[model samples]
Target: MPLIPKSHPRAKSLLIREKLVKGFDNGLVAKEGLLAQGRGEAFDYLLGEKTTKSAKKAIRAAAAQILLAERPVISINGNIAALCPKEIVKLSKQTKAKLEVNLFYANKNRKQAIIKILKKSGAKVVLGSNISTSTKLPRIDSARRVVDKNGIFVADVVVVPLEDGDRTIALRKAGKTVITFDLNPLSRTSQTANITIVDNVTRAIDLLIYDSKKLSKKNHSSLRKIVDDFDNKKNLSENILEIRKNLTRGAKIA
Candidate 1:
């Protein structure tokens, strides 16, 4: 096989892997995060590393849901912190949502590193810094349990980028409207979320910020309808079909 040039689509996926590796070395991402990135890259490659129409609709619906919430929060993990800190800041500002760090493999050093990164990204009110004042999120026994009282604990809606399945389920059981950005549409995080943006976080965050502003002027009823009409199973099937189409085309070309 010939070498993939830096400009190639496969090379872009490799660059994403490099970012995750560097993030882990910098103590901003967990070891498991590297494996997660590899999994996401497989889906990204199959999708041609581009967002689809179904994903666009889901992204807009997620933005609408965030705008309609009384108290919205944007949850950040180590991977998201390393990948899209500035985008997260912009999305939080645009949607008036709280920014909170929620790591699965929690440690003081890693948490502080992510907090510092977000603060430098112009985030003024990043929460979850004080784990001492945490409220129990039922069904979650991991470090994801220790959310701040004024953040995820009280949020009516939350956007979880690079989310884990258990935390997503716990948040829903707590009565919060969950929105997730996961490349794997079949993942539990995607299935459990009220609105799933089946796209890369690097792409989804920026689009969400833009779409939220565009949809902000919409009335409450309109936004509610957007949420109500969302069908996760249908959306997942759409993504699966797209993947199959790409595979079939590649086979024919070969």
Candidate 2:
């Protein structure tokens, strides 16, 4: 597809859809991922497709958590693997975190497809197919209930971009620090996560990678301080306020 001019009415939205279509063709995106993207797109549109200040703070905190963890694992799902394969791989390597695949709609073919995509993106290890070593996450009835023993199950911290709500709650209950990129601040995933980044996944992941690298040289105490200082509720409140303010301003104009 040729690049759409920035002046086009729906340039950004079209481009995002284009990427998803390509991902579907590559088998990296599930059929349901398209619907998930639609839901996310609506939220993104509400945010004006812009990363707010609160979202950046959440990203920074998320980075600190990943860096401070003894074992950090980056959990990738169909949407994320299709959307930010290279950046996700980069983050895993940069933070020395394990790259793992966890799917909502589990299937051998889709799982393998995500793994192939990650490997092609330079990921050496993508851990999803170890049902023999599956560990249960409590209170989740979805496919997310199962995770790899060496991956998310044992990690001190997990970066789960575009996560489902129940799994977010379950991981937290399991004592793993959870970081999520969710555009909707009100969603259970965002409110329950230790660090909720209310931003587009593409933008949020890159920012997180940048922050992780910059914070990598800092001492452990400093990284821990950053994490400790973060308040997920306050950050999410700020995001909601911004959304409300924008909506109010639009209403006044109308």
TM-score of each: 0.93, 0.96
Whole-model Cα lDDT per candidate?
A: 0.87, 0.88
**lDDT for each residue of candidate 2 in 123-214, tens digit (9 for 90 to 100):** 99889787788887777899888888898889999988889888999899888889889999999998899899999998788888899999
Residue-level lDDT for 106 in candidate 1: 88
**Which tens-of-lDDT digit does each residue in 1-254 have in candidate 1?**
23448777467566667777777888999999988988988898888789999899899888889999999999988999888899889888988999988888989899899999999999997888885767778888988998999999999998898899999999999998999998988899988988888898887778888989999999999988987898878888899899999999999999
Worst 10 residues of 2 by lDDT: 130-139
- Off-target runs (Cα >4 Å) in candidate 2 are none
**Candidate 2 TM-score to native:** 0.96
Quote the positional error of residue 159 for candidate 1 in Å: 1.0
Best candidate (score: lDDT): 2
Error of 2 at 39 (Å): 1.4
